[model samples]
Target: MSPLRLVIRLTAVAAVAVLVAACGGAQDPDVARVATGLLDAVDSGDGAGACALLAPPVRTELEDTSGSPCAEAVLEEDVGAPSDTTEVEVFDTMARAVVGSETLFLSRFDGRWLVVAAACDPVAGKPYDCAVGMP
Candidate 1:
């Protein structure tokens, strides 16, 4: 093959590899499972279920809002499931997931992986209070 053609082919192959890696082509099964379960719980409006999957700090925050109006509103909204193509990154004791424009950070606590924080922009219809409270 001509040098230019060879270069083009190599570039195409490299691009595909990068895309696969970015999407976690061979993600750890356990991590994938946890991430999926958490998202499913949140999507289903299972606040208690979702709370169970949160780290101590985050869970405490949620529990603190026992009689808050925000909590009631969140329970009523019934936020739908995240997009199908959520991305998860797993580390030894920490993981980050990107669902749409929001990013969730999780940490392994005790014997389970639980979400600790979520990123959101207030101006974008997602206030910090809502993100921290809901997620």
Candidate 2:
């Protein structure tokens, strides 16, 4: 009704939208599958398998940062095991999987979901800080 009330209403709607966007699940099942597969490989110490799940940019960063093949470098990261995955949020081509105490970020390319970052922690009002693929 009033200008101030209109502004407040708009802000409330925006906040709800953001929350809904951040907490989705299952509708993007491929994202969850790829994310879980990666953590499974890491949990089993299958370095090559883990590497296979990484997005191209992440793979390149791993190789470039470690001066070794991504297959080997992926093993060196300290991402936690996959006890459970929840809060599988998908925003267009990007997705995030909350795996135990960490989060994994994924990207889609040509219909494939690939891990772009793992062991990520969110900072309030800021981008995530990650142990892998942080650029």
TM-score of each: 0.55, 0.75
Report clash pairs, candidate 2: none
> What is the Å distance of residue 107 in model 2 from its true position?
1.0
List the candidate 1 regions with Cα displacement exceeding 4 Å: 1-26, 65-80, 122-130, 133-135
Deviating ranges (above 4 Å) for candidate 2: 1-26
Best by TM-score: 2
Candidate 2 C-alpha lDDT tens digits along 29-55: 888788888888988999999988998
